[model samples]
Target chain A: MGKLSKKEIERVASLARIKLDEEEKEKMASELGAVLDYIDKLKEVNTDGVEPIAHITGMENILRKDEPMKKPLEGQAADAAKLVKMAPDSKDNFVKVKAVFGE
Target chain B: MIKDNILIEGEKCTAASKILENYIAPYDATVISNLKQAGAVFLGKTNLDEFAMGATGENSAFGPALNPHDHTRAAGGSSSGSAAAVAADLAVYALGSDTGGSIRAPSAWCGVVGLKPTYGLVSRHGLIAMASSLDQIGPITKTVEDAAIVLNTIAGYDPMDSTSHNGELPDYTANLNKPVKGLKIAVPKEFFSKGLDGQVNNLTQAAIAKLESLGAHIDQVSLPMINFAIATYYIIVSSEVSANLARYDGIRYGRSANKAKSLLDAYLETRAEGLGAEVKRRIMLGTYALSAGYYDAYYLKAQKVRALIKRDFENIFEKYDVIVGPTMPYAAPKLGELGDSLSAYLADIYTAPVNLAGLPAISVPCGQVEVDGSKLPVGFQIIGKHFDEARILQVAHNFEKSRQ
Candidate 1:
């Protein structure tokens, strides 16, 4: 059975880019560990010859014809505007964000 | 009626997540577009588990959707509101997304009919991405015929969703009159194993017997790999979730954190405040699994096991027309009954396997069980091979008609 230590939880939390408080980290350490422990049973299955598949649908390389755009948004300014307006901080057409690096 | 809530222009498609709270969709999802062309009236969006992550509706950022049958019981979820609405006659039918039994579980718990179409059978272009490969938009309705009608409207290929199947779709309701007489049905012994409540088991077995009386041939089969379904389903779902949810970085759309000094801080703080505990847990688990050193051991191994699980279904379907079992191992649990995340994941055992195999399955109300003075609904699940929805729907419709 695999157990996630608090440190490992913190590390994974960082990778996920979600801030977790001390209490949450502690809870996740045990809860997630229990789940992983259950999942660890998969190691027992002999999957030597099985090929991993991404999706069950056997379709491959589904390419569509590059047709001229019908432009559903052609005369719909409200729709295009609504798309940008969803952003918390949006200007004319672009969304504003904090500086990536401190000066 | 579209559970495929993507960019429904000028409408809020939150997936019940606070992160996407107040985020209005910018364009119509393909399903919604199809429904509109069919002259379907849009009732309204139903509530769900936040980001469609939890099995119980308790994970909804707003509040858990109560089972219409019992106010204290949970409407099985992430499509919690969809099922509850139809169950209560609040809506004629509603659309719901299912990754691992989101639609069926809730429908079963709420005592309604729910259907999860074959993967790529419906367009995913406008639906919010959960576990992209597993996430499917489906219908929760009052009857099997309604499910078929909604499916007829919403299914078919769209150039927008590359994975969408390009084929001539059948009018699902056309086969409603087909009799189940002589239809071969496989009942996997694993579905009746430990963890299934005794009453639920009895009800399901009786439902199977009823089908047999209708002339369906039933056989007991073993699917040894069934044990690995939940683990494999969670691993694949989480990995895909980690990748899909990464798009919500605050700057693009959705709720953003204020007073962040750097972009990194903005990303972390926004998600921490916006996402719920279960969603965060899945993201972290997925991130850990997909992380460099653990990738081969966890993600790749689960995928291989997934292939085996799929093989199990293929082998069974070779001999049977559809597989029948209880949609849920038990009747609806009271709200907050499932305290831990792992327990909730385990409850998905029977439902998850169908998703892993990209098969079509439906949850039809079989009967009711007495629980704590309440008559809780039991669901009988019928799973069919890939693109074999008509066969299953035929069986379900006949079963439902016979009960009526």
Candidate 2:
């Protein structure tokens, strides 16, 4: 739980695609550090050979058939029309997207 | 108003109905079929934090769900609308997803009963995943009994969700009146620290005292990792969310940017616009945490810490039958007063650790805190060991009945 460096914070922000101001970066660094420092306290516990319990109910390897099925809207113009009708904001037979690549 | 009509009919129950119009259940969601046969009408879809990435209802693309209890305050989310629907009597009960308190936090704020059953007790098939390892669907209802009944219907092994368990299904509602005469309850000391509102603190203490009078043993315990629960939760949840939400590319069911000549541009623009700010923040945080260089430093480390947090509860449960605490540090904050996204994220502090541990925790209205003569409901959370939902319900039902 080392202190989060400025470069690390910037990198994280870049991955998140958020443009953080200096104040925000500093604040996040400090807040994230405090959080990490607190979590670091777990090192004290001895988890020797403790089989990590990912799912609790004790079920494992639930298998299902791997058959490729047609989409619900497949070959049903009515379903496609219904989808278009229900879309909150759609245009030109497609859902719209914001400009990200230098529109 | 539109949501109210839909809930009243008990037909067409499906997630994202308003956006999708039809009751098309997601890949493994069983709630659709279960709700239909139970005579519960599905209202046209209510909005959620896209991919269930938010803790405040404000992250929905459709609109923020107003708290039925205090319209001015936020309804806790990603199960925001579900809680709101129940709070407003829009539905007798509504299903909600809990990955780190989405259901319980909002349930607490909205003054309704929210139950996040033992992880895997409920199926996660139809849920749009935020963090795959941590998500579970449970009921938001007006009464503890309603929650139990809903859990009875939905809690079982589902072949669709690999995470679903095949454990014995107990009749949670049948034991509502069972005497909690000797239940040992632990009250975590870390939960009652500063940042808790005075009124909420007093009300919670009173609730504990009342429970004590009801033949339950209330003891003070320390969950060492409890203070770090939020940070660890965010790191792990965001990382999973980053991966889970990557599937919503424009090529699939969700909206895609058409004008973009290239696939990369399409994905970037579509996600940026479709997702709300909080969703974006989590996705970014997740991506950062899971990235190559930071994986060990952040994501893996969080998992290790998560194990410790789980151990804390496991150790405590060895001595106590159930654990109780204030569901939120304070009652629902004013809707816009959270001011920034970080503040809103912190609202989940009280509820997230239970999710990290994958335990069953329920929020029941314990008392009311009056702010400016407006009575805002406060909740008390009763958490049980993994797969101990029946006992958890018994404890909560006993508390609710005794208070009545």
Best by TM-score: 1
User: Cα miss at B332, model 2 (Å)?
Assistant: 1.1
lDDT of 1 by residue, B1-404 (tens): 44424456678888888888888777678888888789888878888888888888899888998999999999998899889999999889999999999999999999999999999998877788889889899889999999999899889977677788989878899988989999999999999888999999999999999999999999999999999999999899999899899988898788899878899999999999999989898998899899989999999999999999889999998899999999999999999999988899988989999999999999999999999999999999999988989999999999999997
Best by lDDT: 1
On residues B92-180, what C-alpha lDDT tens digit does candidate 2 reach at each position?
88888888888898888889999998888876655556688888888889999999998888788765666878767778888888988
Q: What are the per-residue Cα lDDT tens digits for candidate 2 across A5-68?
A: 8998888766554456677677667666655565455455455655555554445766656886
Q: Could you tell me every candidate's TM-score relative to the true structure?
A: 0.96, 0.82
* Candidate 1 structure quality by residue, lDDT tens digits, A56-87: 87877776567865664323224556667777
lDDT of each: 0.88, 0.73
Tell me the deviation in Å of residue A80 in model 1. Answer: 5.7
Docking class of 1: medium
